[model samples]
Target: MLMTLLMIIFAVMVTALALTLVLLISGVHTFSTSFSPLSVSLASTLFGLGVGLLMFGGALLLFLISFEICKLIVKLITPSIR
Candidate 1:
């Protein structure tokens, strides 16, 4: 059935998902490696970029808050109704 096919597809892409996880978890950014694109860096950088912009205009700086940034990024990327 359709559900089984979707599951198979998901299983096939597990390695890719794993690679993404490795990059996210270890913060291993190889700018000189196979991928040297801004988009790729953006995904990782956004997570690494702490300090959120408030509802009002102001800026705050954070020094090394990778986990927070990562969670913020997931919120940004998760789909919403369009």
Candidate 2:
């Protein structure tokens, strides 16, 4: 039950993050075509932030994968308590 709940929560978080990334990319694209200096700066900042978020998400996924792998290894090495 706990694992199922955790999975559902993670799914929601990933979906939200994906949506935010899509929005940020679209915003950057839309702002990049404008002639105003402010728009240009806004676009650049958005691009930077989008890139940072991508990196962070990738790292988080990697960490989670590694953690799960470690857990599996430990489970295999140790006998079940119950």
Candidate 3:
């Protein structure tokens, strides 16, 4: 189904992006610089990913709630419409 395909694609893309970020962080040389880009990138990426996931969860929850409300209304109105 389209939903399953979309989910699979999203999972793959997220995984790829996270892996790329980690790899880039690892590739940086820490000995030459007082400030490590690795740590900064890791922290920022973690925060960003966490916020994104939270937002996604909130949106999904809202969607499900709205869907259930719509379903309930449809059920309540069906008999009258008939």
Candidate 4:
């Protein structure tokens, strides 16, 4: 269940990032731009989404790295438990 939930969250994060990046690359400005209100709004939304997903990506990396470390530790200890 936890893994499923994580997978769903990961999928959503990746989707949002991809969408925002596409818009940005296509020159649709986001909110933070020093330009017209409409373009700034679009750019801002895309930029915000991009930043948020990047932070979330960091969290995902941390989780995966920790999981690997824990698995390694468990394997190291399991031999003596026999």
Index of the highest-lDDT prediction: 2
Residue-by-residue lDDT tens digits, candidate 4, 1-82: 5466456556655665565456444343322343545545766666766765565555556556655655665576567568
- Prediction-by-prediction clash tally: 0, 0, 0, 8
lDDT of 1 by residue, 16-76 (tens): 4555455443443332222445546666645434212120112111212333554554465
User: Of models 1 and 4, which has the larger TM-score?
Assistant: 4
lDDT of 1 at 51: 17
Residue-wise C-alpha lDDT for candidate 3, range 1-82, written one tens digit per residue: 5456446555655655565455444333222232436546766656655555554555455555555655565576567657
TM-score of each: 0.24, 0.45, 0.47, 0.46
Model 1 score (lDDT): 0.40
Compute the lDDT of residue 76 as modeled in candidate 2: 55
Q: Which one wins by TM-score: 1 or 3?
A: 3
lDDT for every model? Answer: 0.40, 0.58, 0.52, 0.55
Off by over 4 Å in 4: 1-39
Rank candidates, lDDT, best first.
Answer: 2, 4, 3, 1
Candidate 4: worst-modelled 10 consecutive residues by lDDT = 25-34
For model 1, the superposed segments whose C-alpha errors exceed 4 Å read 23-82
